[model samples]
Target chain A: MVEAWQWVTKHPDKLAGWTLEHIWIVSVAIAIAVVLGVALGIYISRPGKEHIADSVLYLAEIMMTVPSLALFGLLMLILGTIGLKVIGFLPAVIALVIYGQLPILRNTYIAIREVDPAMIEAGKGMGMSERQLLFKVKLPLAVPIIMAGLRNAIVLLIGITAIAAIIGAGGLGVPIFRGLRNARMDLIIIGGVSVSILALVVDGLMGRVERWVTPRGLKRR
Target chain B: MIRLDQVTKIYPDGTEAVNEVSLEVGEGELCVLLGPSGCGKTTTMKVINRIIPITKGKIYIDGTDTTKIDEDELRRNIGYAIQEIGLFPHMTVGQNIQVVPALKGWPKDKRSERAEELLELVGMNSAEFMNKYPSELSGGQRQRVGVARALGADPPILLMDEPFGAIDPITRVRLQDEFLKIEQEIKKTIIFVTHDIYEAIKMGDKIALMNEGRLVQYDTPSNLLFKPKNEFVEQFVGADRALKGLQLIRVKELMTGTPPLAKADERVVTVQARMEREGVDCLAVVDNEGKFLGWVDRVNVGKGETVRDIINRSVATATANAVLSEALSLMLSSGFKTLAIVDGINKLEGVLSFDAIQLALSEVAQRRGSE
Candidate 1:
């Protein structure tokens, strides 16, 4: 561990670059997951779309049950054949997006579903249009719940981004993968500690954001 | 006035929620749509505002077909409230009340003024509550804000579905009384829904009772009490129908002219003489200005020199506007056969005797039987 600390201090720039890269990849993937999850959740949760919701949730569940590395490898082959970036940042981000889906999508679906039906009826009865109801009532009330899902996705993806280093996406995972190759146990400990710290920081920031966006009406007395 | 002609609602799943119900609520009338749960009372009310589109009939509001008008435009003109209140949790009390007015494009100043005015109208302190969110309010307060929100536009017609159902019993009664006061001042044509028959009797000018998606009986509260259309109504109204009927009748309805009076200054012998001449056991004592002082009973005669000294001051009194049930209870609790009917100033207005109430109910029963 002391040796790894010396090594890290000796290469501060490299460590900083990998940390930024790790953050960027995780953020992009979580952002994509949030948009996709919320939109799909809203569509499936609407009244009179039960069958569509069932089928979509079932497919997402099956996708969730699959092994993450195997799924990432399969995506690499498909993207490689399609002549897209398949080896590094793109494949790694895509894998994280897929992994982040269940938390975001499931939470969004349940949150939107759990909104008081009477409130929606009142909105409709008071002459609010479909679009107005969604924006003014549904989305505002669902924000806290949805934000919680985003926080979960961010933390999960931050940790998963380490695995992406195996596919050539340089991050904190590089040290661990190098440790594995060169039999450096101290480097592996440093990499594991860095990923844990990164998850906590992302989680703490997102929690504050969630608290800020939570509807004032729903705040505990 | 709002009118529904053979309004029916059959969902896609073949559940006929409302079946060909026809009704009319006159201008300024508060009509109650009442029944047990799932009896389609709510569906019947929704059809009036076109919230639940009618499967087979026409609804007219102030002589305009509801279906013919643009739905949003039509709804904007009809106030709606429900049991759960459904106040926008994200909005403050003022913002919740201003929703309809804001939707109609009222200027900011006008909307704010209207919200304050309505909060006061519903008996809330506007300055204290305007900025508070719904969760911060008690259930009863939230219910009041719900009503204020519904009345935001001062719409001529209002639809309320068990608006007070979620409140505690004590608060529910207070809300009901407050609503009654507001109704009298505004006189908007209203269709209120409830399963509690007592609520229907208290709030409705007319009651339309439903069962199994059909209209069972539609009539005034008095008629439903004294002349139920069938056994179902009698059972639905419960065995206390006679006692409930007294609520529909007022002290003024049963009161006759004030009985012969004895002046407070009059001698005890004079009070006895008057009671004797009138063939009654008591005479109401009055002051110089004719305000009721108390009653001088025959038993109190000779107790003192004057009527004031002998007067039974603890004798219960009833107001002219008080329901007969209230007066009756006062009489029963006081062990008196008659109650003094007083005006706001405690002046003698008339007299309400137990015989009069018995006569009124019997007359209603006899009239219904003869019909």
Candidate 2:
């Protein structure tokens, strides 16, 4: 860990770029996941979604079952032959994105569906149209739960992003993977420490957000 | 005015929630739908806003064909509050309250201003609460914000579904009283749904009692208590209904202690002549301050004594919202036929008599029978 800190201090500029790119990939992918996942959750959680939602959920569950590193390899093969030039990190990101869905989709489905039926009745009684109820009441209340899912997704993605460095997606993991291959203990410690710290910081920030936004009634902590 | 004509709701699987319910709520009247679970009280409310679209019959709000209107537009015009106090956790209280107004296309300032005013109306400090998130508030406080949010756009109709159900019993009663005060001021056409018979009788101007998807009775709270529509209503409304009826009926509605009114300082004969003319045994004494000095027993009056000498200073009073039992209990204990209705300063307003109570009961009974 100390050696990793020395490495971060040793190559501040390189660390900065790697950090930025790594975070950028995680953020963009997570952002896309949130939108698509929440939309799908809402769509699936609604009444009469029994068959369709169950099928999609089954597929997501199956995808979640694949090991992350192996999934990345599969994505590499699938995308490498396509016109995609960002192939090195492509497989990594796709695997992380897929991995991120378990919590998010599960939470989204629960959040949207778990809104008190009485509250929905009240929303309707207030003369709120279906659209108003969905976007205004249902969506807002679902936010905390959705955020919960997102929090898990983001932290999971951060940790998973490090392993992608093996495919030339040289994040902080570059030193970790490269050093380990050459049996360089110092470099391995550097990459390992940086990834752990990244996960810790991201996880801490999401904890603050959850505390700030989750309804006191629903607040777990 | 809101009218439900033979409204019935049947789920897809063929369970009837509300069965042939027909009733009309007067404009600005607070009508409570009280029943046990699965009694159709909630379904009746849903049918009004078309949440669960009426499977049979029609609903008219202010005499309009409500069923023909777009559900959302209609909901925007009516305020709905729930027992869960569903204030959107993601939004500030101000934002939550501003929802309907914004959707109604009011100017931004108007929406926010109205939201603030509503917060204040529900006893929340608008400045303190407006920017704070919902998670920062206590359960009772959040419920108040929920009410403020519901009342934000000034909808003529407000629907409350066990709005205080989640709160502690003490808080529940407090919220109910606060709501009653708001109701007195706004006089909106309200449909409050509750399974608690006591609450329904306490808060409702009129109570609609339901059983097994059927409306058992629709009448004034006191009337429903004094006269149950059937064994179902009698059983549902509870055995202590006569006592509940007294609580439902207010002192003003039932009392007739019209003590002789004499100015603060007047000749002793002024009290005498008025007492003789009104045929009152006692008089309510007042001062130049308009403060109630107490009561004047005619027995204490002498041929040439000052009014002060004649007035009995030990007087009991009741406020407008004081339940009938309190005043009646006081009157019975004190051995007085009249209970003074006064404000906080103890200024005399009116008096309560058995006649008033009898009158309210008879009139409500007559009206209920006619219906």
Candidate 3:
């Protein structure tokens, strides 16, 4: 613990770089996950898709069961020299994207389903088209929860990102794997602290954003 | 005008929410669908706009089949407001009001201008609130914004689902009063859904009582109160409730002033003499053309000043369709017992009082029991 504390204090600039790399992975993953996951979640949540949700859930479960290492290895094997050249960032990103999708999709589906029926009815009563109801009323209200899931997923991704160091992803994961290899406790602490700080940072920022989007008091206007 | 012929809504779960209900609302009339929650009042409303597909039936808006219009095109032409006041939290009041107009692809300036106008119409007054976010508003303010957002496009028809249900009683009464006044001026065909009987009576030009997914009774507010078709309608409308009928009686017949009026130049002493001769407690002060100027109390006028000089200025002269809840509140707040009712042109219509309400409710109740 002292060693980790000393590393964070002594090499704050290096820690900052490590933190940036950690954040890079999280933000990229979140951006992609937000777009794709939310869109997919909305599509699956739409009416007449009860069966499709089952299929998607099954597929995601299968993906979740795949070893993160094995999944990246497979990407590496496919990319060959190309994989080694980009420092294997693609493999890490793909793996995190796969793992990050579940919470987002689930939250989005539940949020859309859970929106007060009266609101949707009001939209329809006023002659709102399905698209309008979904976009204008349902989706906006659903944003807070969807963002919650995204936050959880991104924070979770920060921890999982350390595993991507195996694929040579340029992040604090570098120090982690290097420390593990050389049996250097100081490098490991630096890596772990950097990753944790990244997670806290992402979670905190997203939390603020969620409050801004959803607002707290009823008299927000 | 809206006409629903044999409209039925059957959820995929084989549950029927609205069962072969047929109803009609005339143009320039306000209609309320009054029922307990889950009584299909909401489902029936959704079916009109095709939000939920109808299992069977046809819906006509302005006499045109609703199914024939493009869903987006049709919805863009209709305004919707709900009790939760679903103004997008991410949107400013102006942006929230601009959604429909933007969807309709109206020019940017026209849409923004329209939103401003609607904000004013709903009493939010855009100049003060257009830039505000939904989160910054109180319940009543949010509701006003919701109404303004709905009215942004000025559609011929509006659908409101318990729009004022979430506000505090005081704010609710204020919003309800303003809504009634706006409706009088706009006269758009409107379908309103609410569980509050008082709200239904006050807002609906015609109220449709629904029970178990079926429309039990549909008629004018006074007619429904006077002649409920069944025990269900009567029960739903509530029995032994405090004078529901009083809210329905038009204010025109209740004012007790015996045709006392004063010209712009009429002296205080002259008006007092006229009041004494008529034995009237109040005088309807009007301009030369007989427009509703304001109200003056005969008992409170000072002998030393003109009738106008000493007359108590009050918050009356609202449209005759205003509810007793509002009238009573204004009276109580202003420490006055009565308010002058006005017509569309601000002409003297009648006066409203708590005793007058009781008398009207009693008469209607007696009449209903006899019927």
Q: TM per model?
A: 0.82, 0.75, 0.74
At residue B8, give the lDDT of candidate 1.
Answer: 85
Error of 1 at A191 (Å): 1.0
> Tens-digit lDDT track for model 3 on A118-171?
666655555566887898788887877888898888888888888888887878
For every model in order, the fraction of real contacts preserved is: 0.78, 0.56, 0.40
Per residue, candidate 1 scores C-alpha lDDT tens digits across B1-371 of 78888988999999999998999999999999999999999999888777788889888887888878888878889999986558988889999999889889999999999999999999899999999999889998999999999999999999998999976875775577668768889989999999988788877899999999999999999888878999999899888766787778767777999799989888888778778888999898888888988888888687899887888888787666566666777888888788998764679999999999888777655655675
Report the error of model 1 at residue A37, Å: 2.0
TM-score of 1: 0.82
Candidate 2 segments exceeding 4 Å error:
A1-21, A24-28, A83-87, A209-221, B28-30, B89-93, B116-149, B163-187, B195-207, B219-230, B233-249, B253-318, B329-371
* TM-score of model number 2: 0.75
Per-candidate clashes, comma-separated: 0, 13, 9
Identify the runs in model 1 with alpha carbons over 4 angstroms from their true place: B250-371
lDDT of 2 by residue, B1-371 (tens): 89999988889999989889999999988999988898999889877877778889999987899977887788888888876456666577888788778877899888888888898888888899898887788999988988887787888998887888888975675577667778889989999999887778778889998889998889987668767778887777677555665666666555554456775466677787888998977778788766777777777667445776666666676666666756667677767777788754567777887566666656655654565
Q: Relative to the unseen true structure, what is the C-alpha lDDT of residue B91 in candidate 3, on a scale of 0 to 100?
A: 71
On the 0 to 100 scale, the lDDT of residue B28 in model 3 is: 87
Classified by CAPRI criteria, candidate 3 counts as acceptable
Kindly list the per-residue Cα lDDT of model 3 for residues B327-356, writing each as its tens digit.
665677777666777664677766676688
